[model samples]
Target: MIAPVVSAPTVSRGVRLGYGVGSFCTATVNAVPGLLLLYYMTNFLAVPAWLAGVVVTAPKAWDLIINPLVGRWSDRTRSRMGPRRPWLLAGACTLPIAFFLVFAGPPLTGVPAALYVGACFMATATAYALFEVPYKAMPGEMTHDYHERTSLLQWRMIFIGAATAISGVLAPAIVSSQGANGTVGSYRLMAATIAVILLVAMFGSFFGTARAPMTGAPEADRGGWREQFAAIKGNSAFIWITALACTQMLAVSMMLAAAPYFAAYTIGTPAATQTLFAALVGPMLLTMPLWVRLSKRFGKRGAMVLAALLFGGGTAAAVATPLFGPLYAHLTILVVGVGIAGVQLLLFSMLADVIAADAARTGKRRAGVLTGLWTAIESGVSSFGALIFGVILSLGGFIESEPSTPVQQPDSAVTAVLIGQTAVPAVIIFASVLMTLKYRLTPPVGPGPDESG
Candidate 1:
């Protein structure tokens, strides 16, 4: 049977723009540590590779338990400000503080450093969860109009692309300018800047969108924990989408984790590294409109398939860097970036679609639960990617000593880094592409209350 269509409140152009900005700031804060933390730990702070990986991965692991609980809480929260905004505001307030602390570089050695990093990371992760789960859940709550949803996502992608591109390019330059002693200082500055941006964006989003009129509590709302488990277990579409998201994140995280190493060792110049990042992210900003149009024309599934294929092909080409010169490597990486642009842009859009569909089918808006689960899964995959990359570097016999030249690293170590960047992610991304074939949910064509009954 066809589900009932829920009429979502009309979001103004200003509100949409505000949400887009908020998304961009959020992406910046999220991307920075993943992009630079490993390099900071191993090369700058003289931490061992394995230990660095542990620091990066372990704290985020907490999300596995916390995400669902947060989701359930948000789903049931009955507040004057609305269910999602409170958490968003709280996260915004605390996130930057935790972010600064993570990079503040306490003068500790050995186990002390590890413990400090882990605790700081855990705090950041928790704060991120508070913000991210609600923010992600917003799209599904914002409007049920299929075309409007697509438009909203289009705006989101535009800002997200811009933020990622700007931050990706500027971060290295900022770190370099702070002098040799400025790695920690640079990170602090970046965190502070990002925190401000995050705050402004989130505040805007919180005030911008009107809360959906929630009609009733979900079945899991009154049930015990077992009932919640049952609810999650029965939601096959959510399960598949979450799994796909996790795998895709694994691929992205692995590439992000290894990017600095590849730039330093493979391309041999910090300038080249910065340029490579620009080349990778720059096209995305320009192409978001095109991607949005494509998603509408081809439908989300077809668009994702095309995107995944492009990503996989481009990534595989990156693996061929050893066979070519630095120019070829840079070009290949840029190509991979183009593919990533489409994937990154569409994945969240598709998730929004899926969540809306699930609500329609279940007669309950569980955007929070779905987003929470997604956040948890993404955290695990991200952590696993970091851990695995570290293990690989450790196994490859990479040393933490500064190299006089980029090419000075052992051939095996360079190869390992390259493999981590390209070959490993390509495999996971390809699998995710195959899995997207099973995503059969479509945008409903009528207007009514969102129904899952």
Candidate 2:
């Protein structure tokens, strides 16, 4: 006999849009820092490359502690605004200010500047945990249908594409417009402009998701941390998917951290950073529907495997960019972007499935804690990309200097940038494909109540 098919109620389009808009805050916050912070630290603030990497990565380590706490807190919260939205409002009120302070462009340089930026970054991490852990948990609770979850998350992918494209291109363009070398003021302006965007998006999400449905208990499991850990340990699908996602996120992070350096040293123009990001994010916007269909036809697991290959292959091909010129590099990155659309859409959709399944099986409201663990590990692993790349740059003897004094990078340093951007990320993404193969999540095989009613 054929297995019974299970589905949840459809989410409203307005709710989807309102929820998806939050990606503007999430995508821009992630993109701008990964793209520019490393370059900014070494080139603009005159912090040593290795030290700057530590400064950038260290703050995110706080996610290990804060994300789970936020998750558990929100799960148990009882309020008129809902368990998640209050934290969303809190994040909206705080994160942008902390984010802006990170690039405030103070007079201090070297260790002092690193310390200042690190502290600001830590605050941003805390605020982000407040918003993100809960925000991420919503999709799992919003709908019970597996395919519908993919459809809902498709909208999120679109906003992520748009936000990443806008921030990646706009931020670099703003930096380049100030001067070929980029002044302190250029970074400050970029930060301020993006901060406004973050505020609008975060606040918009708080109000937008007002009508979201929750399928699980209104309050979460009151069990302590050990029980939460036990629940996580038993979910095989969550374990595999988290591993796959963390690997993919690490590759993306490394590429982002290396983008500006790749543009300046490999492609021979800082302006190329805009064009490159445009290439990388442009396909993400145009190809999302295709990915949605592919997931439907091939299944999320099959589609994810295909996407991982495309991403890894493109990244590997980009290793020869110096030989073929900028156009070739952009084309390869475009391919990577197509794969990225699928990867981003499927990963979150699958996570929602895992969350919904766990809730149904256990009859507990644990979306918050599950999402908390996912974000904590993902965020921490992503930060390592910068740390790893920084060590590579240091190994190549990369020089650090202020914007007022541009210095010639050694040939080894340029080679290190290229290798870190292309070969290293390609290897990591390929590894993610292997992890994806180990994931065998199928749709839930039953019906559910209409929480959206």
Candidate 3:
């Protein structure tokens, strides 16, 4: 039987753009840390690979706990400004400070450095949860129209692509110019700059949505964690989507973490970090419109499966770098970026569909709890990208370099970097593709919303 259609207000373009600006913050957060943090600690600061991985991932551990609590708090929250905005604003204020500090570790070394980074990063993660949980909850609350949700989120993805591209290209250039002896010198400058931009975006969303209508899960939908857990757990579609999201994030993170290593060893130009990100993400930015059209034409899942295949193949093409050259390898990754655009475009929009459906069927707004859990996986697993690659690098006998002195990695370590950059991502993306075939959710199509969006 067809489920009953749901009703919710249409999201205005200005509001969509404002809400979408929030991506400027999130994309940078996702990009810089994944792209450079572990590299900074391991290569620039001479921290051991395994230790650096731990430092990067440990802070996100708090998300496993803090996010759900924040979600619940937001769920139970009462404010004229709305439940989510206060937290969003608070997070906006603090995230930049933490961003600066993550790269601006003090004049400390060894275990102390690791501990300091871990502590500061934990603070960063907290600030991120404050903004992200509530922001994510908004779409499900804002509209129940499936197609409109896709269109609304397309703008968000565009911003994400733009922000990530900006971060990817600029961060490396800034850090390279600012770094000396492997330590972040004026690196805090880049962090501070991006932090200010994040503040603006976060605040833009907060004020833009101020006059917008807000929705909550009906009281019937409110329940203990057990009940909340069961709600998402019982939903098989959510389970599969979370797995796909987690694995896809891991693949993306691995590539970001490996970028420095790839540039250093394989490309023989670590400074080519700029070229690497530009080549990879440039295609992503350019091809977003094509991906959007594909998603609209083929349904999100079908488009996602197609995207996964392209992503896997495109990344795996790096295996041919020895036969070709750096340019070819860059082109290969460019193709992967195109595929990433598809996954990025469709996945969250599809999740909103699930949330909307749940709200309709249960007469409740549980976006907070569901999104909170989803964020835990997203943040936690994505953070582990560094950890997983670190373990592999450690196992491969990778050399640790100090400030101003680039170490010559053993051949095994070079091999490790290549595999981490290419094969690892390709293999996991293939896994995601296989899993998507098992996804059995009712595709979003056919007649009917109960109301306009």
Give the number of the best model, judged by lDDT. Answer: 2
CA lDDT, every prediction? 0.74, 0.89, 0.80
TM-score of each predicted structure versus truth: 0.91, 0.96, 0.94
Residue 218 miss distance in model 1 (angstroms): 7.8
Q: Tell how far residue 252 is off in model 1, in angstroms.
A: 0.6
lDDT of 2 by residue, 314-424 (tens): 999999998999999999999999888889999999898888777766778989999999999999988999999999999999999987787888999999999999999
| Poorest lDDT segment (10 consecutive residues) of candidate 3 | 444-453
Q: Candidate 3 local accuracy as lDDT? A: 0.80
The parts of candidate 2 lying over 4 Å away from their true place are 1-7, 216-218, 445-453
Please count the clashing residue pairs in each candidate, in the order shown. 7, 0, 4
Residue-wise C-alpha lDDT for candidate 1, range 334-435, written one tens digit per residue: 777777777877778767777767666666657788788888887787678888898888888887642222225678888889888888889998998889
Query: For model 3, how does the per-residue alpha-carbon lDDT over 1-453 read when each residue is reduced to its tens digit?
Result: 123454557778888888888888778988998888888788667789999999988887789998887878887777888777898898888888888888885887667888888888898889998998988888877776667777788888888888887798877777777443234775666777777778788888788877655544464356888888887777776788788898888898888888888887888877777887887777666777777788778867888999988889999999878679888988888888888888887788877877776767666667777788888888899888889899889999997776768777789998898888898888988989988776555543456633211
